[model samples]
Target: MARFTDDNDADAEIRALGEALAMLRRERGLSQAEAGQRLGMTSQGWGLYEAGKRSGLFRPDVQRRLTGALDATPEDLALLVRASSTPSALTQPFKPDGLEMRGRIFEGAPSVERRRLQLSSDELAPWAAAGTVLEYVPGRWPRRDQGCVIEMADGSLRARLYVRSDEVELVVRGAGALLTIEKIPRVQARAVSAVVARLDEG
Candidate 1:
């Protein structure tokens, strides 16, 4: 009886972790296939982890590798699980600017507006090649070295790697031997969206 109880507890924990992982991936605007591609794995392999069928997920190193691929930490997963269990956290009505809410029936679902773009030039090459499709989330800030798409006031879209930003200017890197800095003034950019995944054509 004791052994059965222990097995049930472990199963429950694994399921909770899987749910957190799925939530984090969705929050980053990545589908299972996209997330799997980042880790050089198939979507089915990644799905096993979320289905609580991959026992290796309990390993510390495995947890780090899986979560790191999502740009999240193991600690973040734990916190998410705890927060999800709290009723107030689910009922919170906070909504971010420039984000459109969907699936109103499902409370606490991430309010993300994902956009797609195809590269027409090698300006962001090696990191992203021409013909590559990029999935980006609008209103999400990009971390250093991450890809970003800047929408100009004139309706042109510029794809570059994020370098840094200030109140006045946003610094980005274009294709070059040197890490060239292309600065765009805040007023010129209508929106700066983070590129979450790059899908290269076969």
Candidate 2:
């Protein structure tokens, strides 16, 4: 595994905004297609908002439409906006093999950073709820139909079930959305990690 630390953070900001939109949409149990229909567009159009191809989520009209579609509060959007500047805690030096100790060398290393995420959407409702915390182990990729987090270079992160990969893209299905991303270009992502467990905050 190689460490990705680019001097430019523009891509990072866009990813943050997109991740925010996607998270909010999932929280509300709305798929991109569903949200797009409400907004009078196609799923791809709606996805652009979450992909950071579009911008201004805080604009008056943008907020209105997003809020209407996702049932999100203005404060939620504010928090997402503020997250654009969030420094990633996941950054660590890459060690292809596990840390060398007195005995044996660990593969992929226990040094793999574990990320914790709190659910904020209903897209994966029934199976999961808002405020549920999920733990992910990087380098431990998921198999077919397994839940995992897809990390994108834009800094946007998506939690979906792994489907399959081809030359063009990697496919995944959203747990709550019952939605499939048929083609997520391989270039857009940093890596994928398995979602090993979920923790309830209550």
Candidate 3:
């Protein structure tokens, strides 16, 4: 009976840890296959960790490697487990600093509008590859070095990295066979939306 109880406790801890890892991966908008690719492993291998079948997940070195691939720390995984068990933490909506807004982009317009575009070229390269889907929020100003989708007044669209903008022009970088800088007149750009997320297809 004592041995059986000890096994049950170990299983419960493993399951809790796995749940935390899955939550972190989903929060980063990564699929199991995509997350596995970061660690040079197959999706099934990654799934084993999330299914609590992989005992190596309890190792300190393995924890670091797995969490680092997700751009997180092992401490974050532990905290997430604790937070998940708290009822109030689950009820509160996440609001990052400097993101609060009160007004719509335009009269009769929604407070936020998201649009998706599929990349047909590798112009964005390592930042975003060909066949990756970009989710952008229109009317939101992009920060420097962020990805953006630009709509030209002439009905053409471009995906590039945001550099800076002045009264005269908007400057951006294009990553292709070679890096190129482009400056478009402010008057010619109909809209510049910030890319919020990149979804890579498996």
Candidate 4:
């Protein structure tokens, strides 16, 4: 049994790949400044490559030299190259702050007595989605024929409210069906509020 003693051989393989390329440049006994001259990098920049910092490195040409200098088997060099190029997921911690909150809806409506809502995508299925921020603006008195958002008595839906002279109605455009609330008397028709803007869209 070939017992491996090094615990960090995997990590070392990656570092070895990086160092092997650097060693090839140095085997000519060339100073970093001399290597830098050939590679079009500053001496300090080349050192970052040897240290295995991802940003500063010889890049593609390093592969050419690794084959020559280390006589590294293609399979070995490939393993190192793969390890070097691929980032360790553990090294990058899950940083909530680092995440970008894009498509993030914010309530922009300014109202004195209005409540804002933040609902999940699942909460408002077929209507709103996750990251949907809603600003509940007080409804203006319903106009004759303009589109308005209104709350129902049971508060089942906040839909476009349409008004006729003697009839109150909510026109829901689905299944090619329309709902007319003409049964409710003008005196009893209650308009809770209207949605001024969709917070998610804005």
Candidate 5:
């Protein structure tokens, strides 16, 4: 892994801000669609933004929305822009196969605490795609009724997990304030999980 040094502190700051946005989205336990709804965008739009695909463009309004959605301070987005434009010695480790890395994309390596997830269905589509990246952190579960990722006997779903009188209710979010819940069989609702962060190209 490459090191972030003081000489390139400005660029480091920019990269860190992107990482922070990735973290906030995961912590909220929201799919891209859900997150987009909050930001007045479609899930696909949010996906493009999060994927770091919209570089070399400036949209103040979108930036403001993103800042609010990500809980970032006012100037944080500016720093991200600067870092995105700056060239630094730090680069994504090159694969020996000689293939080129993607351009204008985020490039952070994965840490032990982070693991990637791919959406498998349109059941959560618009909020998450059929193959979207979700980062999971394994540790202290969030409060009951909070969003979670669970692998039960039936299958896996990203829903809010609440414990009722001897039962675990998995609640799924729907479009336009709609929500659904199912009583998960103890045998099936095993291996419940929580999201901690998201992995991006950077």
Candidate 6:
């Protein structure tokens, strides 16, 4: 059996969000096929979004791709969330110009709450190519072989493969080189995020 929320407003919001997404697509003069291509999805998949299928559209990872693909802003997405009956982070005040909050962009809009890393080098080629935009969740621990962004005490950033971790250091392999990054109790790197997805576009 299909599940439906007891709240009547929630149902309406889902329909509204889907409709709003379709409207946004049309305003951008994008056909479903074109929009799908930009978001790394097929035309048929894109159509599902416009059909009022999903009752919610605030998924952080999914929104990152959608906004980035359509060149839309957080404020633009917030407008759609207003019609949603459920509480959402998108309903909060946000600047379309990309504001930062706690190392997050757009005031942590669910669609854009994650940190973004554009690969500067093919140091992790075959998995993450140069020019790839990696979206990750902060404070998310990564397991062995997972792609991650590590912050160092010296304020340096590195994209590496998580090999193993300990209280003292984290073993990583990048660019075919094995590296050990020492941790500083308070100032050193203890921050790591697992790469959830990669978006590559010119």
Number of backbone-clashing residue pairs for each candidate, in the order shown: 0, 6, 0, 3, 7, 0
Candidate 1 lands at a TM-score of: 0.58
TM-score of decoy 4 = 0.26
What residue pairs are clashing in model 4? 121-129, 121-130, 139-194
Pick out the ten consecutive residues of candidate 2 with the lowest summed lDDT. 87-96
Q: Candidate 1, clashing residue pairs? A: none
Q: After superposition, how far is residue 88 of candidate 5 from its true place, in Å?
A: 17
lDDT of 3 by residue, 1-202 (tens): 2554577778878888899998877555466887899999999999999999997888989989999988789999987776766546544554459786454332222345778899999998877789998888878777666688999999888998899999899999985745489899999999999876788887
Alpha-carbon RMSD to native, per candidate: 8.9, 19.0, 9.6, 25.3, 12.1, 12.7
Tens digit of lDDT per residue, candidate 2, span 1-202? 6536652565666667778777766544355776788768899988887887775752668867776676566577756666444434124332448773354443332344678778788655554567877677777877565567888989987777678887778888764455545568999978888776666798
In candidate 4, position 193 carries an lDDT of 46
lDDT of 5 by residue, 1-202 (tens): 7654664664445445445455456665665776677768898887766565553113556667776775554467664454455446246443438676655655654544645666555444444445656666555354444445666575655544344424544444432223444565556666656665433332
Give me the displacement of residue 66 in model 4, in angstroms: 8.8
TM-scores for candidates 1 onward, in order: 0.58, 0.43, 0.50, 0.26, 0.40, 0.42
Q: What ranges in model 5 sit over 4 Å off?
A: 1-23, 26-112, 140-147, 153-168, 173-179, 198-202
- Candidate 1 lDDT by residue in tens digits, 1-202: 2454578878988888888888877666467876888899998999999988887887889889889988999998887877766658666654559886655644566656888899888777666678998888888898777788899999999888899999999999985645478989999999999887777777
Q: How far off is residue 143 in model 4, in Å?
A: 90
Q: Which ten residues in a row have the lowest lDDT in candidate 1?
A: 102-111
**Model 4 agreement with the true structure over 1-202: per-residue lDDT tens digits:** 7745564664565466667556444323244565565556687876665676642233455655434333334455554455456546334343356685555444433434654555443433333455654454455543332223445555543433345444543333212123334333333435634333335544
For model 6, which pairs clash? none
Q: Relative to the true structure, how large is the alpha-carbon lDDT of every model? A: 0.82, 0.68, 0.81, 0.46, 0.54, 0.65
Higher-TM-score candidate among 2 and 5? 2
Better of 1 and 6 by TM-score: 1
TM-score, ranked from best to worst? 1, 3, 2, 6, 5, 4
